[model samples]
Target: MAWVYLIIAGIFEIGWAIALKYTEGFSRPWPTVFFGVSMTLSVWMLALALKTIPVGTGYAIWTGIGAAGTAILGMILFGESHDGWRLFSIALIVIGIVALKISSS
Candidate 1:
């Protein structure tokens, strides 16, 4: 299903983003390779999802979910700063994604 592809794409998006941080501006070999592979998968899945979903709606949902998920992971795993406004903004992103899903139905 397109939703499954979107979920996998989101997961790969996270992996690639984290790997990119470790890539050291592509100066490192292992992380760079990992990032490349994950990024390839992410974009491929996105394209596949587009086969069944509208581009604007699908892209907004995909990116919104990915950004919110990644931000949460960064805050939890990397001890990144998270103040009230950041939390509120991320919550709004979640709500917006939910609204989009609901409207699509």
Candidate 2:
């Protein structure tokens, strides 16, 4: 349950991050609203997960997911770099996230 919340929070963290690009410095109303909502949900879910999960472990995993996910989306959606090294770096972050989850369990 707590893991589920944490995963959802991580996803919302990605959502808010991507939406931020569309927000154009908060000048775009719709994207700004989406960013706000997703950010709120992400934080709320993180709070729920933190009720059980250790703060350091949970926060690291959450940010790891966000960072890796947002990077992938940036490449796919915004024509950002898809270099081998960049991909490898994202994979390492994913590996770290998996390791943290396994260690926590």
Candidate 3:
């Protein structure tokens, strides 16, 4: 289903984002390759998802998932800070994504 594809795309988005952290501004060859492949897959899957899902809703969901997942990963793995404001903002993004899905239905 399109939603499944969207979720997969979101996962790939997470992959690309995390890989980007390891790429060191593309100075590391293997990590940079990983980043490139992950980014390509993410966008490809997102395009596939748009085949069936409404573009606006699908894009919102995809971006929300990417941003939230990447932020959480950054906090946990990359020594990024997680403050109250960050948590609140992520929660708001999640709520908005959910609202979009609901409204689309």
Best by lDDT: 2
Candidate 2 lDDT, 1-105, residue by residue in tens: 999999999999999999999999999999999999999999999999999999999999999999999999999999999999999999999999999999999
Clashes of each: 0, 0, 0
Task: Give a tens-digit lDDT track for model 3, residues 1-105.
Answer: 788888899988998999988988999999899888988988999999899889989999999999999999999998898999999999999899889888977
C-alpha positional error of residue 100 in candidate 3 after TM-score superposition, expressed in Å = 1.4
Error of 2 at 52 (Å): 0.5
Q: How far does residue 31 in candidate 3 sit from its true spot (Å)? A: 1.3
Alpha-carbon RMSD to native, per candidate: 1.2, 0.4, 1.0
Task: List residue ranges in candidate 3 displaced over 4 A.
Answer: none
lDDT of 1 at 20: 86
Winner on lDDT between 2 and 3 is 2
Please, what is the whole-model Cα lDDT of each candidate in the order they appear?
0.87, 0.99, 0.91
Better of 1 and 2 by TM-score: 2
Candidate achieving the largest TM-score: 2
